[model samples]
Target: MKITTPRWALEAAGAIGAEMAGTIAATGVRVVGDTALLSAVPEAVEKVPAAPRIAPEVAAQALYGALAAVASAPVRHSAPAKARTVHQTSSKELVRVLGHRCLKRLRRR
Candidate 1:
């Protein structure tokens, strides 16, 4: 059996393709059966930045500076007491809130 893709997802993919520059091969999203695919060019993968390197003296100085800063900073003995009471919520509350908003929207219309 064949299945159609959502138009909003396709539009989002198109928008992303626009920002991707040379990475995206085609303009829009391609839907095959139940799956959506975005084709990327091989050259796009090659545009990634290489790993960085630092000289031995620079690396040692950076490590020493970080250690000195950490050593000089004051440490907290314990966390402050809670200021307010906390209430736990569940998915039911979320659904109820969303349903209420949807009902309001429908009533407005």
Candidate 2:
């Protein structure tokens, strides 16, 4: 069994999220008067903090962790590869949703 990521896009997002966490007051900040921890209230997440920035090293490692997660996510493979809706695919399909810019860049690779 091998693990794989959803795609380059998702991993990039996760990395960004992790990087932002560091400056998120994380320990405490304006508004909420320094709770030191985000309570995960839907409104709080939506209203304040406005998101934060992280150290570049943290950002890269965060990206790495996302990549690792993609590499280690659980995948459910059906029994014996039988009776499934399978279709042949081309590399083009892989990058189609990636948008013209990304696809064009990958072409260079």
Q: Clashing pairs in model 1? A: none
lDDT of each residue in 9-91, candidate 2, tens digit only:
55565566555555675656555443323332222122343344777899977755554444344334444446543453334
Q: Tell me the tens digit of each residue's lDDT in model 1 across 1-109.
A: 2354565666667566555643443556653442223422222122355454878889977855554454444433233326322233344444444555554564589
Residue 52 of model 2 has an lDDT of: 43
Model 1, residue 56: what's the lDDT? Answer: 80
Best by lDDT: 1
Count of backbone collisions within predicted model 1:
0
- In model 2, the runs with Cα more than 4 Å from the true position are 1-52, 79-109
Q: Model 2 residue 18 lDDT?
A: 54
Q: What local lDDT does model 2 show for residue 22?
A: 56
